[model samples]
Target: MKKRTHTRLASIVGLFIIASIGLYFILSNLEDNIVFFYPPSDIEKITNAKTKIRVGGLVKENSVVILSANKIRFTITDYKNTLIIEYTGILPALFREKQGIVAEGTFVNGVFEAKNLLAKHDENYMPPEVVKTLVK
Candidate 1:
Protein backbone atom coordinates (compact mmCIF):
# COMPACT_ATOMS: atom_id res chain seq x y z
CA MET A 1 0.00 0.00 0.00
CA LYS A 2 2.81 2.40 0.88
CA LYS A 3 4.66 1.69 -2.42
CA ARG A 4 1.48 2.18 -4.42
CA THR A 5 0.76 5.53 -2.73
CA HIS A 6 4.34 6.69 -3.42
CA THR A 7 4.02 5.76 -7.11
CA ARG A 8 0.75 7.68 -7.40
CA LEU A 9 2.29 10.78 -5.86
CA ALA A 10 5.27 10.58 -8.20
CA SER A 11 2.98 10.28 -11.22
CA ILE A 12 0.98 13.36 -10.10
CA VAL A 13 4.15 15.39 -9.61
CA GLY A 14 5.48 14.37 -13.04
CA LEU A 15 2.23 15.40 -14.69
CA PHE A 16 2.32 18.76 -12.89
CA ILE A 17 5.84 19.44 -14.10
CA ILE A 18 4.92 18.62 -17.70
CA ALA A 19 1.88 20.89 -17.50
CA SER A 20 3.89 23.74 -16.06
CA ILE A 21 6.43 23.51 -18.86
CA GLY A 22 3.70 23.42 -21.50
CA LEU A 23 2.03 26.46 -19.97
CA TYR A 24 5.31 28.36 -19.99
CA PHE A 25 5.92 27.62 -23.66
CA ILE A 26 2.40 28.72 -24.65
CA LEU A 27 2.66 31.97 -22.72
CA SER A 28 6.09 32.73 -24.16
CA ASN A 29 4.90 32.15 -27.69
CA LEU A 30 1.86 34.33 -27.12
CA GLU A 31 4.06 37.19 -26.01
CA ASP A 32 6.29 36.86 -29.05
CA ASN A 33 3.42 36.76 -31.55
CA ILE A 34 1.38 39.58 -30.05
CA VAL A 35 0.99 42.52 -32.42
CA PHE A 36 0.01 46.03 -31.42
CA PHE A 37 -2.44 48.36 -33.20
CA TYR A 38 -1.73 52.06 -33.39
CA PRO A 39 -2.97 55.11 -35.21
CA PRO A 40 -0.86 57.15 -37.61
CA SER A 41 0.34 59.38 -34.80
CA ASP A 42 1.38 56.44 -32.69
CA ILE A 43 3.27 54.80 -35.56
CA GLU A 44 5.35 57.94 -35.99
CA LYS A 45 6.81 57.43 -32.54
CA ILE A 46 7.88 53.84 -33.10
CA THR A 47 11.62 53.22 -33.59
CA ASN A 48 11.82 49.42 -33.68
CA ALA A 49 12.11 49.15 -37.44
CA LYS A 50 11.65 45.40 -37.57
CA THR A 51 8.57 45.05 -35.42
CA LYS A 52 5.33 44.32 -37.30
CA ILE A 53 2.27 46.29 -36.30
CA ARG A 54 -1.07 47.71 -37.41
CA VAL A 55 -2.30 51.25 -38.01
CA GLY A 56 -5.90 52.41 -37.81
CA GLY A 57 -7.36 55.76 -38.81
CA LEU A 58 -9.61 57.51 -41.30
CA VAL A 59 -8.61 57.49 -44.97
CA LYS A 60 -7.90 61.05 -46.04
CA GLU A 61 -10.37 62.61 -48.43
CA ASN A 62 -9.18 62.98 -52.03
CA SER A 63 -5.91 61.33 -51.13
CA VAL A 64 -6.57 58.10 -52.91
CA VAL A 65 -4.76 57.45 -56.18
CA ILE A 66 -6.00 54.38 -57.98
CA LEU A 67 -2.91 53.46 -59.96
CA SER A 68 -4.49 50.61 -61.95
CA ALA A 69 -8.01 50.35 -60.59
CA ASN A 70 -6.44 47.77 -58.29
CA LYS A 71 -3.18 49.17 -56.97
CA ILE A 72 -3.98 52.09 -54.69
CA ARG A 73 -2.21 54.69 -52.68
CA PHE A 74 -3.92 56.66 -49.96
CA THR A 75 -3.36 58.59 -46.82
CA ILE A 76 -4.83 57.73 -43.46
CA THR A 77 -5.37 60.57 -41.07
CA ASP A 78 -6.05 60.88 -37.40
CA TYR A 79 -7.47 64.34 -37.97
CA LYS A 80 -4.28 66.31 -37.14
CA ASN A 81 -1.95 63.59 -38.37
CA THR A 82 -1.63 61.25 -41.36
CA LEU A 83 0.35 58.38 -42.89
CA ILE A 84 0.70 57.46 -46.54
CA ILE A 85 -0.29 53.88 -47.36
CA GLU A 86 0.48 51.91 -50.50
CA TYR A 87 -1.26 48.65 -51.33
CA THR A 88 -1.36 46.59 -54.53
CA GLY A 89 -4.26 44.28 -53.90
CA ILE A 90 -7.96 44.24 -54.49
CA LEU A 91 -9.29 46.75 -52.02
CA PRO A 92 -12.36 45.98 -50.02
CA ALA A 93 -15.53 47.38 -51.59
CA LEU A 94 -15.98 49.65 -48.62
CA PHE A 95 -12.58 51.29 -49.06
CA ARG A 96 -12.97 54.94 -49.86
CA GLU A 97 -11.76 58.38 -48.96
CA LYS A 98 -12.62 59.78 -45.54
CA GLN A 99 -13.59 56.36 -44.25
CA GLY A 100 -12.22 54.37 -41.32
CA ILE A 101 -9.49 51.84 -42.20
CA VAL A 102 -6.95 49.57 -40.58
CA ALA A 103 -3.74 48.52 -42.28
CA GLU A 104 -1.31 45.89 -41.10
CA GLY A 105 2.23 46.45 -42.28
CA THR A 106 5.65 47.93 -41.68
CA PHE A 107 6.92 51.47 -41.97
CA VAL A 108 10.06 51.90 -44.00
CA ASN A 109 11.66 54.63 -46.10
CA GLY A 110 9.12 57.16 -44.79
CA VAL A 111 6.11 55.16 -45.98
CA PHE A 112 3.76 52.66 -44.42
CA GLU A 113 4.00 49.44 -46.45
CA ALA A 114 0.64 47.78 -46.01
CA LYS A 115 0.38 44.02 -46.32
CA ASN A 116 -3.37 44.11 -45.74
CA LEU A 117 -6.07 46.75 -45.58
CA LEU A 118 -9.50 46.61 -44.03
CA ALA A 119 -12.06 49.29 -44.84
CA LYS A 120 -15.07 50.31 -42.87
CA HIS A 121 -18.48 49.26 -44.15
CA ASP A 122 -21.74 51.23 -44.25
CA GLU A 123 -22.69 54.83 -43.44
CA ASN A 124 -24.27 53.93 -40.11
CA TYR A 125 -20.98 52.49 -38.86
CA MET A 126 -17.71 54.21 -38.16
CA PRO A 127 -14.92 53.06 -35.90
CA PRO A 128 -15.84 54.50 -32.51
CA GLU A 129 -12.40 55.95 -31.84
CA VAL A 130 -12.30 57.65 -35.23
CA VAL A 131 -15.76 59.14 -34.77
CA LYS A 132 -14.72 60.47 -31.38
CA THR A 133 -11.70 62.14 -32.91
CA LEU A 134 -13.80 63.69 -35.64
CA VAL A 135 -16.27 64.98 -33.10
CA LYS A 136 -13.59 66.73 -31.10
Candidate 2:
Protein backbone atom coordinates (compact mmCIF):
# COMPACT_ATOMS: atom_id res chain seq x y z
CA MET A 1 0.00 0.00 0.00
CA LYS A 2 2.88 2.43 0.82
CA LYS A 3 4.63 1.72 -2.51
CA ARG A 4 1.38 2.25 -4.44
CA THR A 5 0.78 5.62 -2.70
CA HIS A 6 4.31 6.79 -3.53
CA THR A 7 3.86 5.93 -7.18
CA ARG A 8 0.54 7.79 -7.33
CA LEU A 9 2.04 10.88 -5.74
CA ALA A 10 4.95 10.91 -8.15
CA SER A 11 2.63 10.63 -11.13
CA ILE A 12 0.55 13.53 -9.88
CA VAL A 13 3.64 15.73 -9.44
CA GLY A 14 4.83 14.91 -12.94
CA LEU A 15 1.48 15.80 -14.44
CA PHE A 16 1.46 19.07 -12.49
CA ILE A 17 4.88 20.05 -13.84
CA ILE A 18 3.80 19.29 -17.41
CA ALA A 19 0.68 21.41 -17.00
CA SER A 20 2.73 24.31 -15.57
CA ILE A 21 5.12 24.25 -18.51
CA GLY A 22 2.27 24.21 -21.04
CA LEU A 23 0.57 27.11 -19.32
CA TYR A 24 3.79 29.12 -19.32
CA PHE A 25 4.27 28.62 -23.04
CA ILE A 26 0.70 29.63 -23.84
CA LEU A 27 0.91 32.81 -21.77
CA SER A 28 4.26 33.78 -23.26
CA ASN A 29 2.94 33.47 -26.80
CA LEU A 30 -0.10 35.52 -25.94
CA GLU A 31 2.11 38.23 -24.47
CA ASP A 32 4.23 38.30 -27.62
CA ASN A 33 1.15 38.75 -29.81
CA ILE A 34 -0.34 41.59 -27.78
CA VAL A 35 0.26 44.93 -29.48
CA PHE A 36 0.00 47.74 -26.96
CA PHE A 37 -1.72 51.04 -27.75
CA TYR A 38 -0.25 54.46 -27.04
CA PRO A 39 -0.98 58.06 -27.86
CA PRO A 40 1.38 60.30 -29.76
CA SER A 41 2.19 62.30 -26.68
CA ASP A 42 3.41 59.19 -24.96
CA ILE A 43 5.36 57.82 -27.89
CA GLU A 44 8.70 58.86 -26.46
CA LYS A 45 8.15 56.49 -23.56
CA ILE A 46 8.35 53.42 -25.76
CA THR A 47 11.78 51.83 -25.35
CA ASN A 48 11.29 48.35 -26.66
CA ALA A 49 12.31 47.98 -30.30
CA LYS A 50 11.29 44.39 -30.72
CA THR A 51 7.69 44.85 -29.62
CA LYS A 52 5.00 46.14 -31.98
CA ILE A 53 2.80 49.02 -30.82
CA ARG A 54 -0.19 51.06 -31.95
CA VAL A 55 -0.27 54.86 -31.96
CA GLY A 56 -3.55 56.78 -32.11
CA GLY A 57 -4.08 60.45 -32.85
CA LEU A 58 -5.31 62.96 -35.41
CA VAL A 59 -3.51 63.39 -38.71
CA LYS A 60 -1.43 66.53 -38.57
CA GLU A 61 -2.50 69.16 -41.05
CA ASN A 62 -0.59 69.19 -44.36
CA SER A 63 1.84 66.60 -43.07
CA VAL A 64 1.00 63.92 -45.58
CA VAL A 65 3.75 63.53 -48.13
CA ILE A 66 3.26 61.06 -50.92
CA LEU A 67 6.46 59.21 -51.64
CA SER A 68 7.48 57.04 -54.55
CA ALA A 69 6.88 53.29 -54.66
CA ASN A 70 3.41 53.57 -53.13
CA LYS A 71 4.82 54.79 -49.85
CA ILE A 72 3.55 57.69 -47.80
CA ARG A 73 4.77 59.65 -44.81
CA PHE A 74 2.49 61.47 -42.39
CA THR A 75 2.38 63.00 -38.96
CA ILE A 76 0.06 62.26 -36.07
CA THR A 77 -0.56 64.57 -33.17
CA ASP A 78 -2.54 64.62 -29.95
CA TYR A 79 -2.14 68.43 -29.84
CA LYS A 80 0.76 67.96 -27.46
CA ASN A 81 3.31 65.79 -29.25
CA THR A 82 3.55 64.41 -32.75
CA LEU A 83 4.89 61.22 -34.29
CA ILE A 84 5.98 60.60 -37.86
CA ILE A 85 4.79 57.46 -39.61
CA GLU A 86 5.93 55.94 -42.88
CA TYR A 87 3.81 53.36 -44.60
CA THR A 88 4.05 51.49 -47.87
CA GLY A 89 1.09 50.40 -49.97
CA ILE A 90 -2.41 51.77 -50.41
CA LEU A 91 -3.90 53.92 -47.71
CA PRO A 92 -7.39 53.69 -46.28
CA ALA A 93 -10.24 55.71 -47.75
CA LEU A 94 -10.76 57.60 -44.50
CA PHE A 95 -7.16 58.75 -44.40
CA ARG A 96 -7.13 62.52 -44.57
CA GLU A 97 -5.89 65.60 -42.81
CA LYS A 98 -7.34 66.35 -39.38
CA GLN A 99 -8.81 62.85 -39.20
CA GLY A 100 -8.19 60.45 -36.35
CA ILE A 101 -6.22 57.25 -36.99
CA VAL A 102 -4.19 54.51 -35.39
CA ALA A 103 -1.05 52.99 -36.85
CA GLU A 104 0.58 49.77 -35.76
CA GLY A 105 4.27 49.19 -36.21
CA THR A 106 7.70 49.34 -34.65
CA PHE A 107 9.26 52.66 -33.74
CA VAL A 108 12.69 52.81 -35.34
CA ASN A 109 15.11 55.73 -35.58
CA GLY A 110 12.67 58.26 -34.15
CA VAL A 111 9.97 57.33 -36.68
CA PHE A 112 7.12 54.88 -36.64
CA GLU A 113 7.41 52.46 -39.54
CA ALA A 114 3.77 51.48 -39.92
CA LYS A 115 2.92 47.99 -41.06
CA ASN A 116 -0.83 48.44 -40.57
CA LEU A 117 -3.22 51.38 -40.34
CA LEU A 118 -6.67 51.63 -38.80
CA ALA A 119 -8.61 54.47 -40.37
CA LYS A 120 -11.96 52.89 -41.17
CA HIS A 121 -13.90 55.47 -39.19
CA ASP A 122 -16.91 57.15 -40.73
CA GLU A 123 -18.17 60.69 -40.45
CA ASN A 124 -18.96 61.72 -36.86
CA TYR A 125 -17.27 58.56 -35.62
CA MET A 126 -13.86 58.09 -34.06
CA PRO A 127 -12.06 55.37 -32.25
CA PRO A 128 -12.47 55.33 -28.45
CA GLU A 129 -8.73 55.36 -27.93
CA VAL A 130 -8.29 58.41 -30.12
CA VAL A 131 -11.13 60.23 -28.41
CA LYS A 132 -9.77 59.48 -24.98
CA THR A 133 -6.37 60.85 -25.83
CA LEU A 134 -7.67 63.93 -27.59
CA VAL A 135 -10.23 64.77 -24.93
CA LYS A 136 -7.52 65.06 -22.33
Candidate 3:
Protein backbone atom coordinates (compact mmCIF):
# COMPACT_ATOMS: atom_id res chain seq x y z
CA MET A 1 0.00 0.00 0.00
CA LYS A 2 2.81 2.43 0.85
CA LYS A 3 4.53 1.80 -2.53
CA ARG A 4 1.30 2.34 -4.44
CA THR A 5 0.68 5.69 -2.71
CA HIS A 6 4.22 6.88 -3.51
CA THR A 7 3.75 6.07 -7.22
CA ARG A 8 0.43 7.92 -7.35
CA LEU A 9 1.98 11.02 -5.73
CA ALA A 10 4.90 10.98 -8.17
CA SER A 11 2.56 10.73 -11.17
CA ILE A 12 0.49 13.65 -9.90
CA VAL A 13 3.57 15.76 -9.45
CA GLY A 14 4.81 14.96 -12.95
CA LEU A 15 1.46 15.85 -14.46
CA PHE A 16 1.41 19.20 -12.65
CA ILE A 17 4.91 20.03 -13.88
CA ILE A 18 3.97 19.27 -17.47
CA ALA A 19 0.78 21.31 -17.23
CA SER A 20 2.68 24.30 -15.86
CA ILE A 21 5.21 24.20 -18.73
CA GLY A 22 2.40 24.01 -21.31
CA LEU A 23 0.59 26.95 -19.77
CA TYR A 24 3.78 29.01 -19.71
CA PHE A 25 4.42 28.45 -23.41
CA ILE A 26 0.82 29.33 -24.34
CA LEU A 27 0.90 32.59 -22.43
CA SER A 28 4.31 33.57 -23.80
CA ASN A 29 3.11 33.11 -27.36
CA LEU A 30 -0.06 35.10 -26.72
CA GLU A 31 1.94 37.98 -25.22
CA ASP A 32 3.46 38.77 -28.63
CA ASN A 33 0.07 39.03 -30.31
CA ILE A 34 -1.63 41.20 -27.71
CA VAL A 35 -2.00 44.78 -29.00
CA PHE A 36 -2.97 47.44 -26.48
CA PHE A 37 -5.56 50.09 -27.26
CA TYR A 38 -5.02 53.74 -26.42
CA PRO A 39 -6.76 57.05 -26.85
CA PRO A 40 -5.20 60.29 -28.11
CA SER A 41 -5.33 61.69 -24.59
CA ASP A 42 -3.07 58.88 -23.38
CA ILE A 43 -0.46 59.21 -26.11
CA GLU A 44 1.75 61.46 -24.03
CA LYS A 45 1.87 58.90 -21.25
CA ILE A 46 3.13 56.04 -23.41
CA THR A 47 6.73 55.36 -22.44
CA ASN A 48 7.58 52.76 -25.06
CA ALA A 49 7.29 54.51 -28.40
CA LYS A 50 8.49 51.42 -30.27
CA THR A 51 5.72 49.18 -29.03
CA LYS A 52 2.84 48.70 -31.48
CA ILE A 53 -0.59 49.89 -30.33
CA ARG A 54 -4.03 50.84 -31.59
CA VAL A 55 -5.27 54.40 -31.25
CA GLY A 56 -9.03 54.97 -31.34
CA GLY A 57 -10.65 58.35 -31.83
CA LEU A 58 -12.57 60.56 -34.26
CA VAL A 59 -10.85 61.96 -37.34
CA LYS A 60 -10.46 65.70 -36.90
CA GLU A 61 -12.39 67.76 -39.41
CA ASN A 62 -10.35 69.08 -42.34
CA SER A 63 -7.27 67.37 -41.00
CA VAL A 64 -6.93 64.82 -43.78
CA VAL A 65 -4.10 65.62 -46.15
CA ILE A 66 -3.10 63.52 -49.11
CA LEU A 67 0.63 63.70 -48.95
CA SER A 68 1.05 61.48 -52.00
CA ALA A 69 -0.79 58.92 -54.08
CA ASN A 70 -0.52 56.27 -51.37
CA LYS A 71 0.51 58.28 -48.35
CA ILE A 72 -1.86 60.34 -46.25
CA ARG A 73 -1.73 62.37 -43.05
CA PHE A 74 -4.63 62.92 -40.70
CA THR A 75 -5.32 64.06 -37.20
CA ILE A 76 -7.31 62.04 -34.70
CA THR A 77 -8.91 63.58 -31.64
CA ASP A 78 -10.64 62.37 -28.55
CA TYR A 79 -12.07 65.88 -27.92
CA LYS A 80 -9.42 66.42 -25.24
CA ASN A 81 -6.29 65.62 -27.20
CA THR A 82 -5.19 65.04 -30.79
CA LEU A 83 -2.76 62.70 -32.52
CA ILE A 84 -1.43 62.80 -36.07
CA ILE A 85 -1.39 59.56 -38.04
CA GLU A 86 0.56 58.86 -41.21
CA TYR A 87 -0.63 55.98 -43.31
CA THR A 88 0.45 54.58 -46.69
CA GLY A 89 -2.48 52.53 -47.81
CA ILE A 90 -6.01 52.70 -49.03
CA LEU A 91 -8.42 54.20 -46.54
CA PRO A 92 -11.52 52.27 -45.68
CA ALA A 93 -14.66 53.31 -47.53
CA LEU A 94 -16.31 54.50 -44.38
CA PHE A 95 -13.32 56.56 -43.25
CA ARG A 96 -14.17 60.25 -43.28
CA GLU A 97 -13.65 63.43 -41.32
CA LYS A 98 -15.36 63.57 -37.94
CA GLN A 99 -15.81 59.80 -37.97
CA GLY A 100 -14.66 57.18 -35.50
CA ILE A 101 -11.51 55.28 -36.44
CA VAL A 102 -8.82 53.07 -35.00
CA ALA A 103 -5.31 53.12 -36.35
CA GLU A 104 -2.78 50.40 -35.54
CA GLY A 105 0.91 51.23 -35.57
CA THR A 106 3.88 52.49 -33.59
CA PHE A 107 4.72 56.04 -32.63
CA VAL A 108 7.68 57.54 -34.44
CA ASN A 109 9.03 61.07 -34.21
CA GLY A 110 5.88 62.37 -32.51
CA VAL A 111 3.61 60.84 -35.14
CA PHE A 112 1.72 57.59 -35.32
CA GLU A 113 2.76 55.53 -38.37
CA ALA A 114 -0.30 53.49 -39.01
CA LYS A 115 -0.07 50.24 -40.94
CA ASN A 116 -3.79 49.55 -40.76
CA LEU A 117 -6.76 51.87 -40.48
CA LEU A 118 -10.19 50.75 -39.40
CA ALA A 119 -13.24 52.93 -39.71
CA LYS A 120 -16.57 52.56 -37.98
CA HIS A 121 -19.03 50.44 -40.00
CA ASP A 122 -21.89 52.92 -39.69
CA GLU A 123 -22.75 56.36 -38.34
CA ASN A 124 -23.91 54.85 -35.08
CA TYR A 125 -20.84 52.69 -34.62
CA MET A 126 -17.96 53.87 -32.49
CA PRO A 127 -14.89 52.09 -31.22
CA PRO A 128 -15.43 51.25 -27.56
CA GLU A 129 -12.05 52.72 -26.59
CA VAL A 130 -12.93 56.01 -28.27
CA VAL A 131 -16.32 56.07 -26.59
CA LYS A 132 -14.73 55.51 -23.20
CA THR A 133 -12.47 58.49 -23.70
CA LEU A 134 -15.36 60.65 -24.88
CA VAL A 135 -17.52 59.66 -21.93
CA LYS A 136 -14.85 60.85 -19.57
Candidate 4:
Protein backbone atom coordinates (compact mmCIF):
# COMPACT_ATOMS: atom_id res chain seq x y z
CA MET A 1 0.00 0.00 0.00
CA LYS A 2 2.80 2.43 0.77
CA LYS A 3 4.50 1.82 -2.59
CA ARG A 4 1.21 2.33 -4.43
CA THR A 5 0.57 5.66 -2.73
CA HIS A 6 4.07 6.90 -3.55
CA THR A 7 3.57 6.06 -7.21
CA ARG A 8 0.23 7.90 -7.34
CA LEU A 9 1.68 11.04 -5.80
CA ALA A 10 4.60 10.97 -8.22
CA SER A 11 2.28 10.62 -11.16
CA ILE A 12 0.16 13.54 -10.00
CA VAL A 13 3.19 15.77 -9.56
CA GLY A 14 4.51 14.82 -12.98
CA LEU A 15 1.23 15.70 -14.62
CA PHE A 16 1.04 18.97 -12.74
CA ILE A 17 4.51 19.97 -13.88
CA ILE A 18 3.70 19.21 -17.50
CA ALA A 19 0.49 21.19 -17.34
CA SER A 20 2.19 24.14 -15.74
CA ILE A 21 4.81 24.23 -18.45
CA GLY A 22 2.23 24.10 -21.16
CA LEU A 23 0.24 26.90 -19.59
CA TYR A 24 3.34 29.03 -19.31
CA PHE A 25 4.18 28.61 -22.97
CA ILE A 26 0.65 29.44 -24.08
CA LEU A 27 0.52 32.60 -21.98
CA SER A 28 3.94 33.73 -23.12
CA ASN A 29 3.12 33.42 -26.79
CA LEU A 30 -0.15 35.26 -26.30
CA GLU A 31 1.67 38.06 -24.52
CA ASP A 32 4.00 38.57 -27.46
CA ASN A 33 1.25 38.51 -30.08
CA ILE A 34 -1.44 40.43 -28.29
CA VAL A 35 -1.70 43.99 -29.58
CA PHE A 36 -3.55 46.55 -27.53
CA PHE A 37 -5.46 49.41 -29.07
CA TYR A 38 -5.08 52.99 -27.91
CA PRO A 39 -6.42 56.32 -28.92
CA PRO A 40 -4.26 59.34 -29.64
CA SER A 41 -4.99 60.79 -26.23
CA ASP A 42 -3.53 57.77 -24.49
CA ILE A 43 -0.67 56.94 -26.82
CA GLU A 44 1.92 58.86 -24.88
CA LYS A 45 1.54 56.61 -21.86
CA ILE A 46 3.09 53.77 -23.86
CA THR A 47 6.87 53.93 -24.00
CA ASN A 48 7.87 50.48 -25.11
CA ALA A 49 8.92 50.54 -28.74
CA LYS A 50 9.34 46.81 -29.11
CA THR A 51 5.78 45.94 -28.28
CA LYS A 52 3.31 46.14 -31.15
CA ILE A 53 0.15 48.20 -30.68
CA ARG A 54 -2.77 49.71 -32.55
CA VAL A 55 -3.73 53.39 -32.72
CA GLY A 56 -7.17 54.43 -33.88
CA GLY A 57 -8.61 57.84 -34.57
CA LEU A 58 -9.77 60.10 -37.32
CA VAL A 59 -7.27 61.46 -39.80
CA LYS A 60 -6.61 65.07 -38.97
CA GLU A 61 -7.78 67.59 -41.51
CA ASN A 62 -5.10 68.60 -44.03
CA SER A 63 -2.52 66.40 -42.33
CA VAL A 64 -1.96 63.79 -45.00
CA VAL A 65 1.27 64.39 -46.87
CA ILE A 66 2.39 62.17 -49.72
CA LEU A 67 6.10 61.91 -49.29
CA SER A 68 6.67 59.62 -52.27
CA ALA A 69 4.88 57.18 -54.49
CA ASN A 70 4.53 54.73 -51.64
CA LYS A 71 5.42 56.59 -48.48
CA ILE A 72 2.94 58.81 -46.77
CA ARG A 73 2.74 60.66 -43.47
CA PHE A 74 -0.31 61.81 -41.60
CA THR A 75 -1.65 62.78 -38.25
CA ILE A 76 -4.41 61.03 -36.34
CA THR A 77 -6.52 62.80 -33.77
CA ASP A 78 -8.92 61.62 -31.12
CA TYR A 79 -10.39 65.12 -30.57
CA LYS A 80 -8.16 65.41 -27.51
CA ASN A 81 -4.72 64.69 -28.87
CA THR A 82 -2.90 63.95 -32.12
CA LEU A 83 -0.13 61.61 -33.18
CA ILE A 84 1.84 61.30 -36.39
CA ILE A 85 1.97 58.09 -38.40
CA GLU A 86 4.38 57.08 -41.15
CA TYR A 87 3.39 54.35 -43.58
CA THR A 88 5.07 53.12 -46.73
CA GLY A 89 2.31 51.67 -48.85
CA ILE A 90 -0.72 52.50 -50.88
CA LEU A 91 -3.51 53.77 -48.70
CA PRO A 92 -7.01 52.46 -49.16
CA ALA A 93 -9.38 54.27 -51.52
CA LEU A 94 -11.47 55.40 -48.60
CA PHE A 95 -8.49 56.89 -46.80
CA ARG A 96 -9.03 60.60 -46.53
CA GLU A 97 -8.93 63.45 -44.07
CA LYS A 98 -11.43 63.28 -41.19
CA GLN A 99 -11.99 59.56 -41.82
CA GLY A 100 -11.76 56.89 -39.20
CA ILE A 101 -8.53 54.90 -39.35
CA VAL A 102 -6.48 52.45 -37.39
CA ALA A 103 -2.79 51.73 -37.71
CA GLU A 104 -0.96 48.76 -36.24
CA GLY A 105 2.71 49.07 -35.55
CA THR A 106 5.19 50.38 -32.99
CA PHE A 107 5.72 53.87 -31.71
CA VAL A 108 9.32 54.95 -32.09
CA ASN A 109 10.95 58.28 -31.38
CA GLY A 110 7.63 60.07 -30.97
CA VAL A 111 6.20 58.79 -34.27
CA PHE A 112 4.07 55.76 -34.95
CA GLU A 113 5.68 53.56 -37.59
CA ALA A 114 2.86 51.71 -39.25
CA LYS A 115 3.05 48.18 -40.48
CA ASN A 116 -0.63 47.98 -41.41
CA LEU A 117 -3.37 50.51 -41.99
CA LEU A 118 -7.12 50.01 -41.81
CA ALA A 119 -9.53 52.52 -43.25
CA LYS A 120 -13.23 52.68 -42.68
CA HIS A 121 -15.08 50.44 -45.09
CA ASP A 122 -17.78 52.98 -45.92
CA GLU A 123 -19.23 56.32 -45.04
CA ASN A 124 -21.16 54.97 -42.09
CA TYR A 125 -18.92 52.18 -40.91
CA MET A 126 -16.43 52.77 -38.12
CA PRO A 127 -14.58 50.40 -35.90
CA PRO A 128 -16.46 49.65 -32.72
CA GLU A 129 -13.30 50.13 -30.70
CA VAL A 130 -12.85 53.60 -32.14
CA VAL A 131 -16.39 54.62 -31.37
CA LYS A 132 -16.11 53.46 -27.80
CA THR A 133 -13.14 55.69 -27.07
CA LEU A 134 -13.75 58.54 -29.43
CA VAL A 135 -15.38 61.65 -27.99
CA LYS A 136 -17.76 61.85 -30.93
Candidate order by decreasing lDDT: 3, 4, 2, 1
lDDT by residue for model 2 over 1-136, one digit each (tens)? 6999999999999999999999999999887346456888777676787578888899999999998878999999999988899998788888999988889889777789999988846577878899999999
Comparing 2 and 3 on TM-score, the stronger one: 3
lDDT of the candidates, in the order given: 0.83, 0.86, 0.90, 0.87
How does model 3 fare in lDDT? 0.90
| Every model's TM-score | 0.66, 0.64, 0.70, 0.65
In candidate 1, position 42 carries an lDDT of 72
Cα displacement (angstroms), candidate 1, residue 73, comes to 2.1
Ranking by TM-score: 3, 1, 4, 2
Tens digit per residue, CA lDDT, model 4, 20-133:
999999999897346556889877677677778888999999999999999999999999999999998888878999988989988777789999999866567777798988
Model 3 lDDT per residue over 22-85, tens place = 9999999987456456889988777788988889899999999999999999999999999999
List model 1 lDDT by residue over 1-136, tens digit each. Answer: 6999999999999999999999999999886345446887777567686667788899998899877866888999898788998888888888888788988888778888889988867668788798999999
Q: Which is the leading candidate under TM-score? A: 3
Of 2 and 4, the candidate ahead on lDDT is: 4
Candidate 1 Cα deviation (angstroms), residue 5: 2.6
Give me the displacement of residue 7 in model 2, in angstroms. Answer: 20
